[model samples]
Target: MEKKELVMNCTLALHGCRTSYDRSDLDSWYLLGTYEYDGSKLYLNTLDDKICYCDRYDATPLKSWDSLSAMLTSEIERIFGLFDADGHCIDEDVPTTPVVI
Candidate 1:
C-alpha cells in the first residue's frame, strides 16, 4: 500500500493509541515494534522476529479491531475489579499507546 494509505489504516487500527512511523529513506515507512495489528490478528514477533498471532484462549485468532478492543476492555475491567472503586493503575506503567502495521 501507499505510504499515505498505510498511515491512515494504521491510525484507524490504533484508535485511542499513539504511534510513530519512520521514513528515513523516503522509499519506505517502518513501524517500530514487535506488536502489530494488521486489520486481522495481533501479531507478536518472537526473539528471532518470527511473526506469531496472539491466541490467549486457544480460540480463533483475533480478526478485527473490535475484537481486540473488546478483549482489552475486558482485561481492564478485570484489573479494576481487583482494586477499590477509586483505584487507578500507575500512569506510566499502563500502555496508553499501541502499534499497528
Candidate 2:
C-alpha cells in the first residue's frame, strides 16, 4: 500500500480584515469566508475543506457550507483591471497625464 502526504500553508491576518499572504500558487485554493471592516472587504480561504462562513447572502445559507467559492473568486477576477476605493491602481504605478494651463 502507498500513502500520500498532505501539504499545508498558512496566511497571516493584517490590520482590519485584510491579510498578508505568502502563497506561491494562489490559484489552487478557494475562498471560504469574508469580513467587512471600514469600507473594504476581506475574503478568507482554507487549505482544509472546512469552512467558517457567516452571512445571510450565502447561496446555501442554511447549509453551513458549499463549493460555491468560485463565485467570490470570479468577483475578484472581474475587478482585476481597476482601482480600489483608494487611488491605488490594479497594476504598477504609471505616470499620470499632465494638465495644460
Candidate 3:
C-alpha cells in the first residue's frame, strides 16, 4: 500500500494526474486526484493516483471520470515492454558462490 501511495504521489506531482488501479472484489476502477492548472502550469494533489484529465469548453461545468480504459492500456504497454522494446532485461547464465566473512 505504501509503495502504491508513493507511486501515485510521484506521478501526480509530475503529471497533475496519478492514474492508478483500484482492485476490489467485484471490479477494478481508476483512481483520479484533484488538480488546478493555469494554461500550462499544473497544480495537482501529490497523493492522488490518476494519469489523465480533461477540461471542456462548456458553461455548465466539467466532470471527473475515472480513466480506467486509458490507464489499463498504458499499464498493458508497460507490462509488455512495448513502450521500450529494446530495454528489456536479459537473463544470462552466471556462476554463484558463497563465502564466509
Clashing pairs in 3: 17-50, 18-49, 18-50, 19-49, 19-50, 19-51
lDDT, candidate 2, 1-101, per-residue tens? 11111100111122332255655545433444333311222233345433333332443222222334643343344333233444344454421111112
lDDT: worst 10-residue window of model 3: 92-101
* RMSD in Å for model 1: 14.2
What's the candidate order when arranged by decreasing lDDT?
1, 2, 3
Write the number of the candidate with greater lDDT, choosing between 1 and 2.
1
Q: Which pairs in model 2 have colliding backbones?
A: none
TM-score of decoy 3: 0.20
Error of 2 at 10 (Å): 17
Candidate closest to the true structure, highest TM-score: 1
Sort by TM-score, best first.
1, 2, 3
lDDT of 1 by residue, 11-79 (tens): 223232324333233322112222222233333222223222333233233332334445455434543
Off-target runs (Cα >4 Å) in candidate 3 are 13-32, 35-52, 55-67, 72-101
User: Which structure is stronger by TM-score: 1 or 3?
Assistant: 1
Evaluation by lDDT, superior candidate among 1 and 3: 1
Alpha-carbon deviation at 71 in model 1, angstroms: 1.3
| Model 1 misplaced regions, further than 4 Å | 1-66, 88-101
